[model samples]
Target: MHIPFFRSFSRIREPSIAPEPAAEPAPRLGGQLERALGRTVALLQYTADSHDALDDVFTEIDGRSRTVIEELDTMRTTMEQSRQSAQDKAQASIDRLSALSQEAIDSLTQLSADLDKRMERIGAVMETIERSSSELSLLAINSGIQAAHGGEAGRAFGVLATRMRNLAERSSLDARQVAKLLDFSPFRASFTQFNTTLAHSIGDADRRISGAFHSMSASQIDMAARMDEIEAHTRAIPDMLANARDAIERGRRVLEIAQAGCAEMQNACHGPRALAAAAQRIGAPTASGVSVLDSVRGRGVLRVAIEPRAWGMSFRARGASQPRGLDIDLAQAFARRLGVAVEFVERPWLECPWLLMAGADAGAAADVMWSALVPAPIFHRVAFSDPYVHFRYVLVRRQGEARFTDIGSLAGHTLGAMPDPAVPDLLHAHGVRWGRDSLQAGVPRLKNLLIFPSLTEVFDALCAGRVDALLLEQTMAGWVCAAPDSPWSGRLEMQAAAPSDPVFHYTVGVCDDSAADTMREELNAFINGLHSVPDYGQLLKRWHIEPAQVQPTLQ
Candidate 1:
């Protein structure tokens, strides 16, 4: 797709004097018109493709975000389940231990009471036996005294008394022995033994209790492990729930984003529909005219083009292919914006009078020329529009090259420059050693004047390692070196001039002709509208054009 370098402005015709009706009968919309329609179609297709790609990338990002959130939710739920299970198992163990401890205490208390009662019974029996023995011994002593008084007959009685005494003595002895045997005095020892047995029994019971403790501990450990296992298994429930919920949330967000993007796409689609309607208003076509729209229901053609005045430029890396300048891009943008077909025309400069006049000689000349123009002299029969951009200029050099220490160092190398009015006066004042013109002067001189139509081309040529030094603007210089992360950026290099002077303004001009009156007015009005309007400022700022007044965004 070749783009026009310039619009032909040959043989100026006199202005139309009177109000006249449209002269020509509209042809069955010609090839030019069809070409315009075709461009619109191509643009719409491009927009659709771009939007589809963006939507796909967005979907991928959304999916990844959704997955991460879902996993996080699952982790949280799993942690909660494990904590709760552990607490429950600990509580149950405490309850069981409490019951076992109480039961052991009760058994020990009952055994202690039984031992006390048995000791009391043994003491009572021993007391009763001792009393009986004492009574028998006293009776025997009294009987023996009576027998002694009765002499011979008393002898028998005394014998019997003696026998009785002996018997009583034996009985007393046996009773004493029985009393000793029953001697509840040792009941203390029996009680002590009972206490010892009770202690032993209590100890056995305590040992049993200790055994229960071990069992309880083991049970608690097993229960804990079981609880942990349950927790591990149950974790899936909450985790699944949380994951589902998070995934649903992510899905919802993606849907929202999709809706927004869809709305943009829909709006973009509407442009072509409106354009078609406008074309019809001007008597172009209808829905019946387009077969594609009839079947697909995709009416309207969306055409998107950067504004023609945009000065965005791109440069290659340190070593690479020749970077294309902005000339072709600008012309293409204009043609596309106007719904016209695009053509690329190369020219040495925008202001080549011979080039403009040459259209008469060669049928294939420029439709529009996109390049630089300094404040071309007023006498040149060309009237210009207000400047779109203005900037301070600098002398550029290859990166890491020898520095131009003094103005004199610029003498030997070829100097790159665009046509500017103030150059001669500035150069003379600075005593800078430089060139005049190599092509025209044909001077076999050290300084070779290199002319560039626009600084963009110069920077591009710089990237191609074409020129040693060229005049460049600061903002553009920054963009050339900016990394890929930068927006509206490129790659290039520059150096400060030993003497930086008089800034330049960018503008478009047309040869003074009354025949081009209508187009000229349109172009002029577009330029004048830039002053108060903020969007105009936005355009320049977007291009990083300096000397532009910065303003707040429209409400």
Candidate 2:
């Protein structure tokens, strides 16, 4: 009989029952049969035990696979939503830019028209002056000629006429120069060309942006369809596992019948003694490999990567044994959920992602990075959890300095910014020119751009007058300028009405390895849970951070 249950037992040779020899005694032959029966019964029992273990493994794998599918679905949905939001924002920005450009053109046209009207009025005045000067010259010439006929008395009149004639000539010459300078046609043509170029540029930008978003939408649709196919495959796994389990069950029943036959044969020879002893030989099966979640629980510590000088986000005070900040509190809370102690790993802002990617191979690998980091191109390799907070950039200036009121005011002034690749684009978008030493085509003309290594240095430069203004995150700016213990407290203030573009959605980062998926999920759950707790809001308020709106799904 074919025994599917014995697939894992392929290495073990089937016991052979030899036909009885004519010289062999009946009792000895019976004993041989009984011993073989006992061995077969033992093998069947081992197969059943292995089947149970295999069933458990299949169930666990099915559950994990389902969870993975659900997470992927959530990710796909979130990505679609993010893409839609970005497209909407881009469109709104494009519309605003178009409107501003049109406004500029309208204002230029009106200015040109006003200048033309003024020039016309001036020209008319010049013509009137010319006519009066010509009449006065004619009168002076006639008086000079008539005074010559009146001899000595006429000599004085001749001198007066000569003075009047000289004055008329000078007035006429001045009028002609003024009239020539009043010509506005060239100015009007230059204005028209500028307006046309601006309109063309705006239209081209609009088309490019539209095409990009259209292509992105198409790509996202394709990705979504692929994800759906993957989910369908994932959904089929449990059924496949169920069918396998049923086959194992049927094999177990067949083994049970074979075991009965073995029992009967053994009983007929040894009165159930051999079968009872065989049952005593079977031991419990060893457990399957531990999961990443179980491993973390076993270790009892969750290492969190943190940048210590992130102002209101995460930081360590002087002489303090433990670090403190909004992220610290959140990390401790996450550790509490995991039933583990929180271990803070000191790392630079840019190095945290690399450390996580190193995984267990690195001595200082982190389970999660909870610093105030935003999703940027540099961190493409890292997987990020849902955003827990949102922040925007602001223009900061020294107190009593009213020159820097908005991003537009930053033009022609030295501006301090953190060393971020996105800073240049952000500045240039707001009409501030980048001043990098290396010349690049299409780059704005250098005004003054100073990149500081850290927020501390940036603030120091602003205070020391090395930089006229600073582009900083609103939370950090508020914390530094308003915190009672801060050295910059009361010395600087944020410029009112500053543009708040490029809002940052700060999220928890982890290595992209499959091993970290469980950790990422756990973190996402923890973050989602925080919204309902009053302490979370209080923590944000304490840190001067404005809590972001929680997504409906997370809520």
Candidate 3:
């Protein structure tokens, strides 16, 4: 009834191997060893699972980090482009403004010279009038004295003398009024002051914009360097992931060995739960923060609001719902820059501002408004990009009609004018006196003013002989005169509203509620990028309007 453990070992002699009762202790020790091996196997398994879990976490982190890195690279590229564009735009603007300033100065100088010549001509006319009036007055006085001496025979002479004196006096008054029209000192002073102020302001703006561009370029360079460092670090995520995977592999090998030995160590006393906790504590990585751009990149769509108004900046082609215009081009460009698809929503011109301001609770909204000719007061409600186009008033007349020589000629003739904010100023600048009355409360008053609902109506009136001439902006006038199908085509010609006039600027609008500050900066950056070429002029030309350079687009 005795069995000896390790009977095959040479250390124990076969004769000494006896059926002793000590076999009980041998089995007990073997059972404890098997339990201990089982516990070791469980611990190893927990460690392997922890390593695998940690590796999976790291793999996810690596993928997300790479996505972030890619987005950062895109941002860096955008910044670089924007910086370069800003610099180019600033330089171009400086050159253009300088040239324009010089052009303005030259024009004013020429105008001054012309005025001097006209004043000389007026002086000669006044001298001739004075000589004629004095001779007539003397002849009348001599005739009157002779008439008094001749009594009844001179009655007819007396009557003729009185008429001659009256005619001479009237001619002298007319000459004095004409002389009053020769005052050019005020215009010269105003031109000088405007030129000096504009030059100084332009110089200051040039310096500021130049400095800003330089600063932005430097910032972009620094950001690019920082991005490079971050990218280098992010690129190591794969290796880190590999190491984690290798750790899991080694842990798996160890677990396999322990699993094989589990039956031999029955006396194992450690708990598997404690082992798992330890493994988790040692294997897990610290939490990585979320990336902002990554969170938003999945949308891949940009929403835009556009007004498809015909014959203006934006319009839809006939038979096609798709929009075409400067705004559409700009919006498409912006979408390309963002690497997104455009979703253009049509809205009324008056509702564009509201679309940007409205929230989803109000139904729907757009990020920004495009192709708006905003006024100064509206800036309080939203932000505006720099002007991309400009327009000025022009007086259009029928060809072969008596050419308008002066502002006085407009007094008694029927003048067709549109109800625009800039029309009154244009009229006033031409020295054409007007008044505001209850007949048309908000419209300018002229001697023979004809109010119209629209510029098209004004042009139609001129062509139909309902009005003597049409008063409209140069852009619209150009459109009308150039249109082959228009009634005024071949019959109308454009003239300046005044020798000089101010221009109306057109700009884009960003809503106050839609990250307006950032949107303004981004929009401005995009606009600055466009200044590398004369796209503004090209766009106007494509639309059959005058180039911005000739009309001079303002910021």
Task: Name the best candidate (by lDDT).
Answer: 2
Please give, for residues 27-122, the per-residue lDDT of candidate 1 as tens digits. Answer: 433432453343333323333333443444345345434544664565556545555554565565566556656655665576567657766665
- Provide the TM-score for each candidate, comma-separated: 0.32, 0.45, 0.39
Report lDDT (Cα) of residue 522, candidate 3.
67
Q: Sort by TM-score, best first.
A: 2, 3, 1
Each prediction's total of clashing residue pairs, residues at least 3 apart in sequence or on different chains, is 18, 0, 17
Candidate 2 displacement at residue 484 in angstroms: 1.1
What RMSD, rounded to one decimal, does every model reach? 26.0, 25.4, 36.4
Ranking by lDDT: 2, 3, 1
Q: Which ranges of candidate 1 are over 4 A from the true structure?
A: 1-346, 350-370, 378-380, 400-402, 405-414, 418-425, 435-467, 473-491, 495-500, 541-544, 548-555
Q: Give the TM-score of candidate 2.
A: 0.45
lDDT of 2 by residue, 1-555 (tens): 334644534433343333333443334344434433544454454345446545654664565476567767776876777688667768876786877678787878888788888777787768777776777877777776777677674776867677787767778776776767677787778778877977787777777777767767776777776575455345435434544554465446446544444433434333333333322221110111333455568778887889888887788867778888888888898899989998898865655554453321314456678988776655544778997876667788999898877777665566777746667677666655542332566544434555544667678878877678888777677777777876788899875333346556678997554556787888889888887998888887887666434332231
- Please give the range of 10 consecutive residues that has the lowest summed lDDT in model 2: 279-288
